[model samples]
Target chain A: MEWIIIPDKKPDTHVEHIYREKTDKRILKRNPWRDVRLHGTVLVLVIIAELIGTIKIPITKDVAITIMPLIYTIILGLAFYLIKPIKWIHRKQARIAEGAMMLFIGVLIAKLAISSGQSIGLIFEMGPALILQEIGHLATILVLPIALLLGFKKEAIGMTNSIGREPNVAVVVDKYGFNSPESRGVFAIFIIGTVIGTIFISFLVTFSLSFLPLHPYAFAMASGVGSASMNAAAIGPTLAAFPGMETQIEAFAGFSNLLSFCVGIYIVIFIALPLTERVYDWLEPKIGRDSIMPEKEDDNNA
Target chain B: MPDLIDSSENVSVHGIFNWILLLFIFSVITAVGNFLGYHHPIEGSLIGMAILSFITLIGVWLERYVPLDISSILYISVIGIIVAFPGMPTSEFVLKYVSQIELLAIVTVFLAYVGIGMGKSWDEFKALGWRAIVITVLVIAATYYGAAIVAHIVLVLTGVPAV
Candidate 1:
């Protein structure tokens, strides 16, 4: 029986090409300060975002999802880019800003590290829970069958193993080869995660808070899913829910995130990768489909 | 170690100076964010921002010359912890100033850059197709909740009081 309900399209390697190309010397040759328009636009966006302040939308009496300026700035900057009339930022400028983004993240890491270091006492106190929660990251492997059932082949390994951060992508490409189906899968999700994962996480944190009876500290540990922006996004709402524990919340999330960064790659390589292979072998034959073709439309519409 | 160095080939000696300049730019923006959003005074926030930038600069330097083969983030983090760890002479000064600048203030700037950088990848994102989107969301949810669930259980087993 041909499970031909869908048409299989070749995984687009163009995205992968651009990802590697951005690191070229062109990014280094240009002085970031010269991009006045990009800098000015970002400054304006930050000012506007901060001015809006934090807004908490109440889902129920005790549960409200906080929307902070961080969220607004990202959305506003993205809107600025998508708007055709502006023409303020072009591909070259966008690439420059992208290079700068890596440098800026270090500042956030510094702040979090300071918090984690200062609260070293608390970190040690909760050491067991803190260290144990890292295993939760491995839960991603459990969803392998879901991706397979959705018609993914070996790409399922990439999509299900981790959240596809830079390190995760590097691990996949290193083991599976750059143009392999596995690499393609990881890059695809990496792009999506970068684009909207922060927003989704901010909401997911509060939304889970609304119903779950688990401690805020547990959620704080979970928020450390290895990406800094997503970690901050998860921490934002957790801070809002429990007003007085900001320091501890930040410390826990920061420590958990640090642990993820330090050891998460090794876990991916040793445990998650092998588990994914075994699961793919067992499940692909059982539930995998041929492909599910979509209606032909403009890819640029988004 | 060579792989680590190769991955960061973009960062030449010239690139390091540029990064330092950009770090100052970030501190300024972050300080401005601190003033408007968090109501902290710009003077104190700027000082804090500069301190954080200094730590990051040292981390970058270590990553380049130390041959540790570790990520700069780890170096920056250890440096942060050491300066503020209890009993350290500078802990009080470091905490008092750095605490003035909220974490979200830094995040807003980071995400703003993320948004702007996103333009070049928009088409590539769109072309990733729906299955990728579904699996990506599932992966995020699974990792998030999975970690939370495990943490929750462990916290209970360890007899830690719930917050």
Candidate 2:
């Protein structure tokens, strides 16, 4: 959230200090190209993922969900990084990879944008519906009462303000300062969302396909909730579910996601943030507790 | 590592060139994934990559010089739309080759970077506590399904048939 990752343990090296201090100049200087180990690791992960191919699990007799290479690569790469003794990835290399992720995402956007253009007719046809679906982002406020019931205070405001992407983090930091409980709330959720949101959305969309009676196009439009990876994850399984609808699904999702990237900042600031504050003020006294998240080192189950 | 410090510290030149290199690298890698996963020919994938990368670079260029606060994605999307909007001269050529490269292939590459990047954040993730994790999931679900439900209603109202 700080564009810097603060470690739990004491820092020892200049690199660690630079990271903790968030020296953007020094941080950006580390060449992404120098991380050859990281690049080689990705090449292998891609091969492994593609070779395994797509696997379908029948959730029921009529409806089956599938996992593709997209899911496999992420799981395999995460496993490689988390295995500890592998030492295939250093913390610094991971940071460089994070920076590279932003750059690599451009190809995807370009591809999806072309697809969006190809289906411009459909996008125009569903323009109102596609735009209105973004109002669904406001539904995040639905969690405010639930969060309060579970003992969160103002932290719920930050958690529910937006989907906690980088720009949303900026909004919270600007308004509430980095050290405030609100920023803490936003940061925690943002980190988790980045790390796990893709896999979670992929499964959620796949499961919803079996039971939800909505048109697949609606699901496609809804899939574009700002984050590119999450949007891609949502669209991937939807494409698998509706085999012939690839162009329309990709178009709707891409255009909707583009809207979010452009309009999402203002909506979050003027509408969602204020709405969350008022809702928290109104609902906190009615169904809230004074409990804070316990800072416990014992539960290292993440 | 000379490449690390070769360029000056200015974000415009150094950052832009680095961004281009990243696009090139990813494009090459994605071509391989397209061949393996989607069964598209590597040559076809590479051609598609060239077109996509060109559009992306132009968009990035416009974003830098346009003196507007709009996101580079908007420029990219607009350029893409113009170049492939059915009647444009380039539309046929653009769509033909680009379609050969499956979206999932690029997605596979993108997420691989995301997963590896997430490695360093494991400790920070663990420290978020169970409460934050629960709330994060709920928030994600609400946004996703809530949007779907709204779109579903609109579609029904507009008489767009459900699939």
Candidate 3:
């Protein structure tokens, strides 16, 4: 093998220019508050919403728990849609915005863990029942036929993760390169869900807890689909639904979520993804499209 | 300090100080919000949030060592719970407030950020088209109901009281 020993010299001007062009300003500026106004607006809204929720209001507890998040979520989404036309969210802001949710996840989980610590015995006692709730994750298979029906191609396999947690996403992204259409498909759902999943989960879980024959504990365990934010989202309202079992429910949910995170990847790789493939092939001619995205349009997008 | 924090603009971010400051302030401010929202003992919750913030900082640092996806929250959850109370009350404070503070308020802020982030990717989403919407809705439905189904069967099998 021939090794070339090159001089340790600075890049030429053209090379530097080419390199600079590829780099985003966010890499250079690193302004924490470049997007502060927009970020601040959201933060302020949350605080106000928090106050509104805690203080007495005319709305009944049932309506408030079920619909409050949904209302704020829609308004916020509309605001986001409106600002997009004006280029309000630039690359740096986009980075912060994307990361903002996970930032608070620890705090919420920390609280849940504290409750879990108190109810550790409860977790052990409810072992098999708690473990069985993970079977709900098997429902990701439902997306198979739906994605195909909606004209998804092979990439629809990426959409099988119902939890939208980082681990499940990692499983898919690792299998299919980040630039693959499959990754893009999963990423889009992940983003959309992160933006709105909490509200939807809160509403749906509470409603399900009301009429479903299953105990609130079942939904609590179900909440632990590997994502802290989603767990918090699902568990918060369930706590309200079963005010007395708040700590026990969170304990079960937190531990179950941890279990899910540990086992989620294997299930996705060995079971879920392959199952989706068979279903994809079986239904392709009847429902699948050529591709989710037009050819190479986002080839450069990561 | 600002210059130091934002000094590097590359593939990897190198702003430990800024992150530390931001995270500390975030915990404190959110703690205050929770206090106002839940009417929990302000002092206890504040100290708890501070300790948890510090623990979270440790988790952040620890992430560099642990290559896996799990970090921050759960890692801190276990440590915080074990070390807290009778010793520091960090865990108890959090446990007290966690139930009462309206979680939607906390969630909406993050969701709003995600919405703004999605704003930047409107084209990508547009390219994804209606199928993205259909796929997301259907997947969520399947996930929720599927879990409920499993829960139903489990309750029956274990002979646990349903609801």
lDDT of each residue in A52-143, candidate 2, tens digit only: 98999887799888888899888777777898787868776677777677556567788889988899988899998988888878999999
Cα displacement (angstroms), candidate 3, residue B132, comes to 2.0
Clash totals for all candidate models: 2, 0, 3
Residue-level lDDT of model 1, residues B79-103, one tens digit each, is 9989989889989999999999999
lDDT of 3 by residue, A122-158 (tens): 6767777767666678797877877776666756777
Docking class of 3: acceptable
Fnat computed for model 3: 0.42
Poorest 10 consecutive residues of model 1 chain A by lDDT? Answer: A1-10
Q: What tens digits encode model 3's per-residue C-alpha lDDT throughout B37-86?
A: 66666566566666555666666555544766455555777675675343
Predicted model with the maximum DockQ: 2
**Candidate 2 chain A, run of 10 with poorest lDDT:** A12-21
On DockQ, the stronger of 2 and 3 is 2
Which regions of candidate 1 deviate over 4 angstroms? A1-27, A291-302, B1-13
Model 1 global lDDT (CA atoms, 0 to 1): 0.81
The DockQ values of the predictions, listed in order, are 0.55, 0.56, 0.40
Chain B of model 2: TM-score?
0.88
Colliding residue pairs in candidate 1 = A6-A291, A6-A293
List candidate 2 stretches off by more than 4 Å: A1-28, A293-302, B1-8, B12-15, B64-66
